[model samples]
Target: GASSSVFSASSLASSLLSPFSSAVGLASSGFVSAAFSFTGDSTSFFTSSATTSACSVLGPLQHADYFGLGKLLSVRELFEARVHLGHKEGLLNDLMRPYLFGSRLGYHVIDLDKTLQHLFCALNFIAHVAYRNGIILFVTRHQQTAHMVEETARESHEFAHTRWWRPGLFTNSTAQFGTVTRLPDTVILLSTLDSVFEEHLAVKECNKLLIPTVAIMDTNCDPRLITYPIPGNDDTPAAIQLYCHLFKTAILRGKERRKKDEEAAARQQQEAAGTASDASKQPTSA
Candidate 1:
């Protein structure tokens, strides 16, 4: 029920952006370059100190409100994440190459990018849902090109501060894949469909009762295993690159929301403390 309301709102918002305008060239020329370049020192973008600080301030991901403030939606944030992620990895150039050269090779190349982009967009939609609902996002094989996703997420948060963003990264080894185990409260398992297809029955059974999965479903795999499947080419580097960007974008939007919530909580605490201190100093009621 909660997810349905959010989905309705997200769908409406998504429709507002004309399909053609979804292309990443809305801003000034060389916008692609400006957007992609993680801007001064990627380390600064997500310093070790910042990560620690965020963890401390936000507290453990386990105590987060899974069904309340976490489950919100923002279509624009999702789109921005996709564009930002793709631009960051130079995949945008590969994505656009087909359009630049209208030859047959270009057309085929473009198809892959297009499919990948569509999948990314679908995943973004799902991420928006998860973030709003305070769902935990878990990524299997964290070492496999996860940095690209994390970097884009960091950039997206830097730019947009909103209520539907909380970015998190998790590895599969630690993930207990049974009965929607709520370690992080809201778990979003991310993995390639191809990897899991061989164990289709098992994967299906795992996903059927618990856990909301957002998977990169390549042409070779069956879509049934994933709750939110983004269909595209699984083998191409470009395809993986594109999905990574999209995932990062969605995560960034979620993180932005968490930041806002933290700020609001701090303000409330400060005000409450101030009120208490002022009351203490006030003249006796008698």
Candidate 2:
């Protein structure tokens, strides 16, 4: 049974952070994944699997990849979706070099291993948020994929911002929306930049509002600005669709869990009420 606790930020902090902090490896997470396997090198910070177990050093929180969204896409599937293809080597951001597998011809190849790790973190975080009935907002500045992104958001029952962002949308929501508007607890950024040289202003505003962000960062985009960065080819329609499918599945799973928990809680309350009435009907012992 789900614990009878409100899913507040504090309740979810461990769930969201531990996975990412596990040295960029989701295999050690104890998540039930069927289609993927993590190489021993994924946990570079630890000795080979021959030596010590990943759980030996990590806490219980790290083992709680409860959503099991990791199994949604194998490295092979990601490759098929063109998720590993990056921008030209010349446009590569120095910060994102760590996620690069190597240069292929003139283009940089993203390390699918690392992308898988970070994607696990991203999917897990959003799932927990959905479980808590938190709001999610998807953002992207890519014109070619804007319609698809918005459609994904609608299907997932979330919000999207594909058009030009209004200044003070988050910073001054009350005035901008003509009333006190509720801000999203988290934001999913398909692309962090509006153009090759210009960064999206919402990135800064989200930071100012202290909203957590999960972003698909291309080679040329800086990953440091994102809370959970999945290094991949953000511009590819196929890649974006793959991401949408995985995230939507995760969110629906979270909501399903939440509904079950609520039903269980209500049943418990009704049972308690019936017991109280039976006790009242009996002669007073006192």
Task: Give the candidate number with the greatest TM-score.
Answer: 2
- Each candidate's lDDT (Cα)? 0.38, 0.76
Give lDDT tens digits, candidate 2, residues 1-286: 3222233322333444555444234433333112223543232111234223442355323433445565575777888999999999889899999999999899999999778777877887788779879999999989889988899889889999998888888998899989878899989999999854477888889888778888999998887768888999998899998998888998888888778868987999999999999999999777
What's each prediction's TM-score?
0.40, 0.77
After superposition, candidate 1 runs with Cα above 4 Å error: 1-202, 284-286
Q: Candidate 2: where are CA atoms >4 Å away? A: 1-63, 275-286
Per-residue CA lDDT of model 1 for 25-113, tens digit only, reads 22211111101111111200111343345444543231112112222223333333332121122233242333221223222222332
- Evaluate residue 265 in candidate 1 and report its C-alpha lDDT on the 0 to 100 scale: 84
Model 2, CA-based lDDT: 0.76
lDDT of 1 at 223: 50
